[model samples]
Target: MSYSKPRNDYINAVIIPGYTYDSKILVTQCPLEETVVDFWTMVYDHNSSIVVLLDQLNRKTPLWLGRQEVLQFKDFTIVQDNSPNPEELKLILSHKEKDPMSITVFTTSKVNNDAILPSNVLLDLLKKVTECWKIQKGPITVVCSDGCSKSGIFVALKLILEKMKIDDEIDVFQVVRTMQVRRPEFFTEFDQYEYCYRCIKEYLENDSVYANL
Candidate 1:
């Protein structure tokens, strides 16, 4: 549970282990209109500076990220910044008496919540996320609809990449098995699991991609 709304069982969220203190990913569902404030509160409480949205935004999402509206959510006041592309949005969040924080949002190419994004599309998302991690050293929050299917694939790959960067090797089965203990049904589909292996192989065999990881 986050510092914000500790007793409320509103938002479905969790913290997955990561390569660094600031590299952990908080997996969660897309917030409902009523839960939007809780979503930002969780982000603020976790010090998460980036949100990787893996599906199309629901009606409430836009109102929450309304352009030019400095909406106040509980103790936090959020302001939207310029979007570099149609798929991404940036926001500056001010938590009452605390310093303002930057929160960048990135989306996968697919619109369906449970869609198993293609390997190529996931690769592109990884590249974009690498850039976001460079800018913010806090935890990254990832959302789909339910938070465990596609988000699982993305988080698993993210951890694999982080390990590859430092160790140059990884055990695919061990990584997925361990994550499943904490997050049941992670990478729910068999195809997604195969895609993970395929992605790893692509990264290891390709010097250009390996260099970046």
Candidate 2:
């Protein structure tokens, strides 16, 4: 089944295969004010419980609701539950009469546009998302303002980390090259290319940090 609905359903989003599942990722640009409802519909329809908001958005109203606050948009209602950190939000998305789905929204402002996230922070974020996926077992939605470099790099590192766990090997080059075929704008910069290798090396150096992951 395709996580990507028809063009009319949700625009500017595409499905990308993940390390363990065939169609396990939905990479998209930050939703515009007018398209926010469509974005939530995509999440609701796809049954995605994890949302990785890579960068800070410039919009007036934040996409997520505040603690214990709820917002309604067309057929969707978003409720924000308490979270341990401000960076991670627990959201419940409900459509009309269907069962409400709990989604974890991981947001990081440390990554500015075109800027790479620090290796340690990126790995920590990846580990959290990975662990969530391990228990939930579904597609992850990754969003960035422009939906290219940062989001793509995040997914690339995720796949690389998964590959390391399964095969005990790392091939940053091949993983990136393959993802680029599906989304041409992924990992577009040379620095981003180099950052992947740096992250892998860092993960190796601090094995204990992610020992459980």
Candidate 3:
């Protein structure tokens, strides 16, 4: 089955935890010139469905789009001091019904935790996010911290596309370049890039074979 091409002309929005030179470069280089919304503070724009942030840390902050424009949502912070059960985390996410978009804010601790989010959980998140993009009339822009630890999300996204048999149409290079512009530190670690590349390649090959069968 073929999926429709993503509406690439829509404005791209980026979510970052804080202002950084790398993040600035990403915004400047992004292909979407007309609607590049930056979320410096924790604010949401209903007009733009895309939400980008450095990591999950800024989920609670007020989303300030521009002067006099403030969007607020129930803030959820990762439990760092004490690790909460996954059920507890799910309950926290379920509390906000107003926001149809599932919101998740995590820290590096999540990357470290072996049992925090199982591989299946990550895969499910990727599938859900892509499904959202398929239904929406616009392209999906993801903003995350730069590094190997943070690379899991993108890897998972690419896997989802591959599984759906649309990997060829996806521009992995553009995605990586856009990410590099957002987080120069991401490429500073060669190992992280290698890991991300390997993960994507493995997922694509495996999924492509599965689709063929």
Candidate 4:
């Protein structure tokens, strides 16, 4: 699917964390009302897409909006893994309809598990985002919700960008600010934010010099 020419106008890809559809309550809080025209245009013009990540907790299968019914919403490619392999994750990220202007939804088991949010997962997401940047003609927005879990994903994403040496290009503060605006209840704990920052800093400072265990 070919995307229309890119514009400076903000195009958002909302990420509602978890499997339960009840989480959609947060959508009402999004700045969609402020950017209604632009958001709708991106949707109708096929210039933007919504990428949602469903948590593994919900037994009920999640539903996505179809393209014909709406503007252009694609079903998320669920990544079901306790600890996914980097190459496998990369393959999954590459399965988009458009080469450069597509949004991806990544769902994981939990947010705070020290064992679950591995470097490989972060790397895969970063790779996808960078790939999007290379192909996308305009700025891409990633909107995440459901409190700290979504923040954790954002943290991991920032870490991956740092590892790839593109941290300067992407504004971490702006990303987090956007998340806060979307869901005021999100990132309630400062510790979670600190943890994410530490994780990214540690990875950047030591990963290159340290040998793999």
Candidate 5:
């Protein structure tokens, strides 16, 4: 539980083990208006500096405030910063009397619930997020509508890529299996599982992609 409202310890989120790194991936559902505070609290508590949003269903409003807009949630204040990329938003999370922290939110190609993104699109987003992770050195938060579809696929693919980078090989089965053990909703549909293979095949066909990972 994050250091937020007392007795509000429950949130639809999970920390998945990372490749050669424990607790490196934080996956959670999109925050409703009521749970938005809890969502930010989780991000700050975990010291996460990067958030990847995978879809926009029911997300008519942006989670982060607009430029120069301030949202005071309990003891935390979220202030927006100028962002160059329309898809990406930057914010400073300031806790009461504590040094403010910068967080970058990356929005991927819009995807529908329980649907899959093209392999190339997925790989491109992963490259960008991985680059940011190298600097932040903190867990990356993956968000989606229910926190399991696109979030799971991205995490599994990331681990597979990391494994390939370090060991020069890939094990889609083992990676997905390990993640599914933690949350059955991961790869909930058979098509989703096949989509992982599609991503792997795409990754292998492009030599330049290897360099980015």
Candidate 6:
């Protein structure tokens, strides 16, 4: 499904196929100024209930942030709830119960923007991501500065661990191989690819539940 307004190719986020059983994950770029509304529209249109942001947004700009400001644009009234961590805002779109959307913003550290997220940090993040999915479910939209660079790593981890949990074993290389076919350039960098391997090993080596998983 391609977007029509503002007309562009980047507006169409890639959907990683073969996930017919679980929540759909859409790899997309961090929303631009003109596409903020369109971004939300995509989320709503796809029935995506969770958005995982992994990039730093401009603080001063209203790209959809302020101490607390609600945004209203065509069929969506998004209310921002920011308290403890302003950077991690929880959004409620439209209703208070079913079909409302939730967003969590987080960005990992990188040197010269080339390094992958630290393995330790990534493991912890994966645990938290698992917890969130358990609670909310998804067609989770994972967005980063350039869209799928960091996001792809996270998705690969999730798919591997999830399969491990079910089958009691996993083949990381195979999982990533299939992923790259669905979305080109997934885990394309050597360091990032190595980081993913380390993250899975770290989880399997230490965690008891996932060790058996």
Candidate 1 lDDT by residue in tens digits, 84-156: 5756787888876678888777875475754667777777787888776876678889888777877888899
What's each prediction's TM-score?
Answer: 0.85, 0.90, 0.40, 0.41, 0.91, 0.79
Which residue pairs clash in candidate 6?
Answer: none
Which lDDT value does model 5 have at 27? 94
Q: Candidate 5 on 1-213: residue-level lDDT in tens?
A: 446546376778888988765338989988887777778888888889999989884654356667889888777898889887856788999889677789988876556565667788888888888888877778899998888988999999899888887788888888888888888889868887788888888888885865677
Q: Order of all candidates by TM-score, from best down to worst? A: 5, 2, 1, 6, 4, 3
Q: Which model, 1 or 4, shows the larger lDDT?
A: 1
Best by TM-score: 5
The positional error of residue 45 in candidate 3, measured at the CA in angstroms, is: 4.8
Worst 10 residues of 5 by lDDT: 1-10
Task: Kindly list the per-residue Cα lDDT of model 4 for residues 151-181, writing each as its tens digit.
Answer: 4455434433443453345355555565566
| CA RMSD per model (angstroms) | 2.7, 2.8, 12.7, 11.2, 2.0, 4.0
Q: Top model by lDDT, which number?
A: 5
How much is 20 displaced in model 1, in angstroms?
A: 3.8
If both were scored by lDDT, which would come out higher, candidate 2 or candidate 5? 5
Residues 5-48 of candidate 6: C-alpha lDDT, one tens digit per residue: 45543564777643336656888876667777667767766767
True-structure lDDT of candidate 2 = 0.81
lDDT of 4: 0.38
Ranking by lDDT: 5, 2, 1, 6, 4, 3
Q: Lowest summed-lDDT stretch of 10 residues in model 6?
A: 105-114
Error of 4 at 51 (Å): 2.7
Better of 2 and 6 by lDDT: 2
Instruction: Candidate 3: give the clashing pairs.
Output: 15-52, 15-53, 16-53, 16-54, 42-62, 42-63, 43-63, 54-145
